[model samples]
Target chain A: MRHISHTDINYADLFADFRDPNSGAVVMFSGEVRDNNKGKAVTHLEYEAYEPMAEKMIDEILNAALEKWPLNKAICVHRVGPIDVCGCAVVVITSSAHRAAAYEANRYIIDRVKYEAPIWKHEFFTDGTSEWGQNCDCSSPSHPHHHEHKHHHAE
Target chain B: METTIQVTCFAGLRKFFNCPLTINLKLPTAYEDVLLEMKKVNPEASEILDSCRIAVCESFVPRTALMTSDEPLFIIPPSSGG
Candidate 1:
C-alpha cells in the first residue's frame, strides 16, 4: 500500500496482509519523529506532500525495487500533517523467499522514497522555532549522495 | 495567446508563497520561465527556488522542457521523507 495518511499508521494491519507461505523473510522499516535534531529540541513535525505526485512517486519507487530485486511483496505508507515525537512518520515492508532479498529490497524502497517522493518535513523546535528538514542533499555538490536518517529505525 | 499555469508549492516555498500561485507566460514556456516569473512575484524566494525542481503530471521534468498550462506544476524542494 503506497499511501499518504492523515492519521496514525497501523503497523499491525499492514503486516496482516502479508500471509504468503512462499515468503520466508519479511523486513519492515519504521521512521519516527524524534525529540531532538541538530542539537535543537524538536517539539513535533509537520509533514506535507504534493499528494498526487507523492503517491505516484512512492508507487514508482516500490515498482523499481520490485523490479531490481527478487521480492515477493513491497509496501510503503507515509503520514502527513502534524505528528508528535516518537510518532511513526513512515513505514516500509518487503517480503521475499530469502532474508537477503527482503533486507536489500526494504532498504532500496525506503531510500528511494526519501530521495524521490514529493514529501516535505517541517520540524518545530522547543524554542518556538521551526525549519524545513533536508533529508537528502543530492543536489549539493559538497554533500554525499546518501540520505540522512532522521530517526528511522527498523522493526 | 497567453497561458496561465498554476504552481503548487510545498515546504519552504509554501511558507513563502502561502498558496498555489498562478503565473502568466507565453504559450511555449519552459520550466525556467516559471522560475523567472516566480522571482518577479517574490524576489525573496529566489534562493529557495534555485534549489527546487518542477514536476508536471506527476513526473519531474527538466528545466528546458516546455510546460503546459493545462497541468498544474509542483515546486518540490529537497524531500525529507523517511
Candidate 2:
C-alpha cells in the first residue's frame, strides 16, 4: 500500500522497496509523455490531478488489480504537475510468486490508472499548440472510454 | 436519517466543482449520487464525470459504481505522473 512520488523516479530504489526474496517475478509498467501524440510532434506535456480523490481512486484500482490477479506485493506511483517530454508519468510494480501474475497485473494497473483516475494531460505540439485528451469545457461527465495509451516503462 | 459528509476535492477535480473542498453534503450519499449533485453545482464538471471512474476506500466503481457503502468515498479526476 504505497502512493507517493515526484517526477524523479529511481526504479532501482522502487524495485528494491517492494521486492521480496519469496517473490519470483517483479513486473513494472511506466507511462511516459511521448514526443508525438495523434500524429503531431509533441514538444511537452502538462498533467493535472485531483490529489486526494485521485489517490483514493488509484488505491481502488490497485485493489481491483489485486482481486483480479495474484501477487506478492503491488505498488503504484504517479506524477503530477508539468512534465517535460519523455518524463515518467506513471509507475506500476507488481511482484508475484509467478511471472504471469506479475506481468498481467502490471499491465492491468496502468490501464486502470488511466481509465479510473482523474488526471488530465495537455499535449504541447511542435506548432505551439496543445490539446488535452481528457479536457472538457469544465462540463459533462468523463467516461473512461479511450483505449489507446502510451507506456513510459515496460518489461 | 441525514448527516453531514465532509469531502476534500483536489487538483483538476477541484476545478470541476463549484463548491469548496470542504463542503457539507448529506451523509449516506453514494459517490455517483454526489457526482450527480456535483453536476448541478458545476455543469462544467458533470460532462467530465460521464467518462470518469470513482473509488470508495480504494476500489474502482464503474458508472454503475454506487456509493451506498460506508465511509471514505473519493471522486478521482484524470491524472498522470510518476
Against the hidden reference, what TM-scores do the models get?
A: 0.89, 0.62
lDDT of 1 by residue, A34-143 (tens): 99998999999999998988898788888888998999999999999999999999999899999999998888788878877888899999999999987665446854
Where does candidate 1 clash, by residue pair? none
Q: Which stretch of 10 consecutive residues in model 2 chain B shows the poorest summed lDDT?
A: B18-27
- Runs in model 2 with CA error above 4 Å? A1-4, A135-155, B1-82
**Per-residue alpha-carbon lDDT of candidate 2 for residues A1-155, written as tens digits (9 for 90 to 100):** 44645466566788887767889999878787788976999988777766666677678778887898888888888876677787887788999888999998887777667654667676789998866665322243653344322211112
Q: For residue A23, give model 2's deviation from the true position in Å.
A: 1.2
* TM-score for chain A as predicted in candidate 1: 0.87
Top candidate on lDDT is 1
DockQ score, prediction 2: 0.23
CAPRI verdict (incorrect, acceptable, medium, high) for model 1? medium
Write candidate 1's Cα lDDT for B1-70 as tens digits: 8878888888888767856899888778788789889989999988878777888878878877877665
